[model samples]
Target: MSFIRIGFPSLQQFCVNALVAVSLLVGGVAHAEGGPATAQDGERVIKLAAAADKDPLAVMSSAEGRWFQKWADDVSDYQFGPDKGVFWFHNGVAKGDLMRVLRFHHTVTTAAFQWQKKIKDPRLNPADDDAKTLAGVEGLLRAYEVLVAKNPENRVAKIDDLIAIRNKGGLADFVKAMPPMPSR
Candidate 1:
């Protein structure tokens, strides 16, 4: 007797659909395993981010950034399957520094706007105030130079790691730091 072969498109579709459903179920369960971040933890993360942004030079000079970079690189090597998650965590952390930079820019802009408003005020000297603002901006730029000199790849690397952390739990920490929303 000759061997018989069977090819069924409907059967293949059923198998595919079953696999998709099972995968989604398992993924949802795995994601639900991690608990939410506490408010204290969130605040700590926010503070770390703010501090890094405020004085990147200081952070680069300290042992912390060096240690963290090494740790992150080490993690990158061993955890091949979770690479995306780790990178996301790093990116989230890096965004904190960027947020600080944006805040600094806003501060300077606000100061300039105030100076302009008081330009003609008898008590306020717009020129002197403007000079101080420019000085502050120059100082920040210098700090950035120092930071980059110490860790040339820091900003990008940190960002990648933070993104991974966010995907895992770092983003939750940020949200917890935010004031609670009022009930509708």
Candidate 2:
């Protein structure tokens, strides 16, 4: 059998492309149409966040706009970075009217995302393992729904539950245990 030989440069490019594809898939940044993300795509998310009753502009400006820049770069490759753009996205799993939902969104964007990207501990870094980030996001989304179903006013309990679940490494199980979001 004859084997095909590839050059190092070709292999490196292939690896880079493969990594980009995998990251897009896992990062939830890929468009539904399977094309490279664009400024409009990022803008759409920002609009959705604004409609969700959260201040996208404010979040964009928070923490000296550090996280905001990273999130924008993730989706738009800095074509419209936080310095020049405001962006946010609600997955429609949580109600924006609920204070708990709003707070959770803020926490996820500012705190959770930071930890997931930076922390070495698996317990703190949801992105440490394959699919863990998705699981964590889904868990938080479901938790928002559960809290909305019960009481939207109390945010302390919501925060406590999040901390408890993260500490216990139970995000996937927590997602399974949550009641389904009511159909609109």
Candidate 3:
């Protein structure tokens, strides 16, 4: 599956921008007049987003959440269809599961971080590793989504297993081993 990606200097920058935009959009700070929004506004939003342990969209207004969902769909191949409810994470995995996964852990974050650090190097292809990692991340999300729907009773344990697989850098392997998720 093709993964949607945000064009930013780094995943960190993307998160900062997302938080800032969410804050402005939700707070009614970003108006046609340009308003009084300042760098500090973005900073406050960044702090809030950083500290959040659940999906970043959780705290946003419905409008803001819809905006974010569209943005994620446009940028990354991950689609949060309108019919599906919010709240992406399951029992055991919290803090940086989807986009956040690209930031923390021994997940693709490590590779993406390294790539971002060396972004200036001409030899490095920005899309190479990050794209694959993103696809893996999307796979992980899809797996969780299906497991929770199909086997609600074992969601906690399934999430634990997925987290373990992710931590061990086996996202693709784990996804490949799973039964196919039903098409939306």
The RMSD of every model to the true structure, in order and in angstroms, is 24.1, 19.7, 13.3
**Model 3: pairs clashing at backbone N, Cα or C within 3 Å:** 3-77, 4-75, 4-76, 4-77, 5-75, 5-76
lDDT of each: 0.35, 0.37, 0.37
lDDT of 3 by residue, 43-132 (tens): 333333332223322323234434333333342212222110112232224433333332221222222222334322212453533443
Model 1, span 1-184: residue lDDT tens: 3211112235654564445434423333221112342333223323333344444433433343343233223422111111122222333543455434423432332222323343222114535444333333333333344344445643455434434655575554542343322334
Q: Which candidate leads the pack in TM-score?
A: 3
Off by over 4 Å in 2: 1-57, 60-155
Candidate 1: 10-residue stretch with minimal lDDT:
76-85
lDDT for model 3 comes to 0.37
- Where does model 1 exceed 4 Å of error? 1-95, 98-123, 154-184
User: Which 10-residue span in candidate 3 carries the lowest summed lDDT?
Assistant: 77-86
> What TM-score do all the candidates reach, one by one?
0.24, 0.28, 0.31
Order by lDDT, highest first: 2, 3, 1
